[model samples]
Target: MSQARPDHLTWRHRLVALAMGLSLLVLVVRMVELQVVNHERYIEQAADTRASGAATLTAPRGAILDATGYPLAISIDTWDIYIDRYVWAQDPDAASGAAIALAGMLGLDADQLMASGTSDDRGDILVQRRLPYERGAAIEEADLWGIRSLPSSIRSYPEGDLAGPLIGYVGLDNEGLWGVESDFDHLLRGQPGWVLHERDAVGRPIAFGQHAERAPEPGGEVQLTIDRFIQDIVERHLREALLEYQSSSGSILVMDPYTGAILAMASMPAVDLSAVGTDGAPEGEALAGSVRNRALTDLYEPGSVFKTITTAAALDLGLVNAESGYEDTGVAEVGGYAIRNWDFQAYGWVTVREYLQRSLNTGSVWLSQLIGAENFYDYVERFGFGEPTHIGLSGEAEGMIRTPEDQDWYPVDLATNSYGQGMAATPLQVLTAINSFANGGLLMRPYIVSRVVTNDEVRSYEPVEVRRVVSPATARTMANLMRDVVEGVEWHGARVDGYTVAGKTGTTIVSIPTGYDFDTTIASFAGFLPYERPAVSVLVKIDQPGGDVNLGGQVAAPVFAGVAADIMEYLDIPPSEQLVAGQ
Candidate 1:
């Protein structure tokens, strides 16, 4: 028998029992709260862990249209076929059958598709890309296991290869790769949406499972300043010029002088949008060679075409007048270098009009000397040389100009630069600079896209005037001088039947890493038509004409005439009475 327990010990035992009961009560209350109050939260958490899948809803890329609202580049509904690897791994036999069925239906390699689906890494495997909408819909309706179809699109050019380089193309992911596509990709590619759905063990979307989706927003419509008819005419004339002149390559640009709108731009060896990625399409270096918009990318000496700038500067500064006389000894000596005229003949005591008509290099050197280096370079910079025009295009080059501040600068450079040698400029830059004359001495920034239309609003772009390079009087005088140059019998090739063309011809020797290629020349012409009220400013350049006759007036001038004449007629521009009277 045990002795009677102490009172203190008994109380302690009772207290311990009370603490245990209280702890148990607290636990039961917490369990009730978790199970009843927050039941749905836990349920959602568990479901999320079990099935999590999301997919992108591709947005249709924007359509690129011409000024007349004709589509140049568009996106057509398509589909991307994918294989769920984990689901396929779960059943090898099913995977093989699916691959064979897909191969027969969509023209794919069964063995390759099977291997891709059964690879060690488990994820979605892309089996085919850019399938037609109807075919993809049929595949989806068949309900093949582990096979998936995602909404997609393929870029289509309805006009075929008409403006391939200018409109550019998209890549496999629908990302822009060149030209307008690359430059304005942000506006062209719309925001993509997404979908969330309950998935199975292999992360494949479950049929009839809970689904939620956000609709994709389509891209905006880009309206370019380009005219389809004008582009066709320019391209036709450029191709013909290249063939007739036996030139390796060529480019043509037509711009509205008053508005600085690019009506048409064409480059040779252009990629055909319809044939890209096909069996016979250009690839690697060949594709790269053909894809560039040479008018804005390639740099070359403007030759005599640059003389327009020199003459304008001189007239603007009052350094020379149209009747100012100069002695042409066939050569002008500067910095121990002899600069001679194209014909290597002397015209004794010639006026400024005669010198320009003859395209005398000596006369250009004399005028540059009068304007001085500082003022001449200042004028050049004001006219937008040695810099990019920032014309919203990919791969636009900023041409090189040597100034007195540079280490390589020489005194002879002033003379050569005046005649458009010992320096370089893109064809677009040359045209833009000369366009100042037609625009009444105002230099306007060149642009391609005229407006962008979106679902919500339309943003129209206007002509941007940069600055005035010369006085209106000086511009009028220069225009008259240019008109005289084109009207001269020697440059008859540049004449239009019912138009007075104010123009200049350029024939530059191809400069190489080692000296120059004397056998080849870049023949070019820059001009504006209707003399009094200029409608279009045109530039035509042909590279490396074979055989004889590589002069700009002979090879490129005729091309300009053809393009300008057609454009004038298409635009319903009437023949000028001034031109007819002058003729």
Candidate 2:
């Protein structure tokens, strides 16, 4: 005791003690501030450090199903991969290894993968993501120290190019950008859920502290009017027709005549939505190819397709009977707008059947004149032209009937419009008008969506008649005359043997800007099966079909015949063998 008291502490010892005391106190204060003052914040950070990971937990998007529940688009389980840049930096050469590993997992070029940008702050790199589980597991088993995989989802189209345009794709952030996906994004994209927990100094979850997770709820499924078999038929024939006609672009639409439910819709140059990000093409180019929905968004002067409406107008207004006659010196001048046949050769005299059979522009003009502009315009409006179909698709064109809206309706406008010129409409618009004729008299709004289904219940979209656009009597006579346009003697017989095919052919010259020497044409044909109680109405439009023989009767009508005949046979609807000999 005496020795200890006598040997007092040195100055250095006292100074060291004081420094230790201050450091301990400071740490205590900091701990209290972090653990109590901002308890939730620090706890969350602690959880993240120990067990949890900051990541985008992608919510599963809704499935797009055909009418019979065949999936057009579906989301499948995938792996979300992350990389610890700090760990990779440990071995400088490992960065290349990391890229090589990811590229192998993703079936991508190793060089391209190695060069992708990374977060400069050494944050966890969202490296390869949405990998199929097996591929991700393989990468993980390789013990790529810098890499980790978490659960995620990616949209997959199993049918490969089937209804690709209809069911659009989503991004990693689960954003809908086009087609039905974008149109019904809110309903399709479900709410994302999160996890709350504590972590250590390093960003790893605590593994047990207040571990809370709210699993994501899947979105409702949308059932479309598309029949997978029917869609396949439409696609095949459209491509075949495009090849046969050597056209720049083609559109084929098949819809239920009475209900307006679109059975099959196909457009050339359609994009596979799932291929947007997963393919070799640069991201920008892949996206550019799918910017527009050709069937609904694009509009063209519906050459002969417009004639169906004119034919309906003629019959409805009693301007011409089924056997009405006309004189076709191969040309007819009306209201100072000279209309001529594509051949520029006049038949001294022809019946209405021969006029339409040959797709004579003059004959259509004469019919419109006989019906009078007011009456003709009324029938056109009744056909649902010049207005949005409101089919729940994004970016629908209302189409154009310039003369109807203009008070100063020039004779040229009226005359050109009657024969499908001076008028612009989309393929969908043409389908709707023709469907009315196919349905006998009633006009129904064309719809692609057939049902909305959740896991527990299904909401079916029943067909509702929007309006009776024409009298049954008017519809019958129009169909009769249109029957002639298909089977009539004056033009190419665009009819399937054993089927009572009734259709109209149209050839519209694209409006050339002043001083342009070249002439461009849009040829179209619209028809229905059996002439009455039709199961489907098929409309085929070929744009810029430049050839020595470029009439709708030659180009588009034949396409209608091919598609409609196949569809009828598929449905087991026996051919009526109905004939129309001369337009």
- Tell me the deviation in Å of residue 94 in model 1: 8.9
Q: lDDT for each of the candidates? A: 0.88, 0.74
- Per residue, candidate 1 scores C-alpha lDDT tens digits across 207-263 of 898666667789988999999999999999988888888988889999999878999
Question: Number of the top candidate by TM-score?
Answer: 1
Model 2, 1-583: lDDT tens digits are 4554575789998999999999999999999998789875664554455543444356787888888888888888787777665556656577777778677767778676555423342447676668887887787788775676766788878788776667676766787877778787777777665455444455444567456555667877888888998889888888887777777677888888888899988877677654566647435654554556678888888876676678777877677766787777767777665677767888767666666666677778778778877887887888788898888888888887766558866877877788777778888988788877667788898898888876567878888787888888988877777776666654454687777778877777666666222466777778887774577888888877765767677788777777877787788875463333321
Displacement of residue 401 (Cα, Å) in model 2 is 1.8
User: Which sections of candidate 1 miss by over 4 Å?
Assistant: 1-52, 83-127, 141-147, 204-210, 578-583
Looking at candidate 2, the ten consecutive residues that score lowest on lDDT are 574-583
Q: What is the TM-score of each candidate against the true structure?
A: 0.85, 0.79
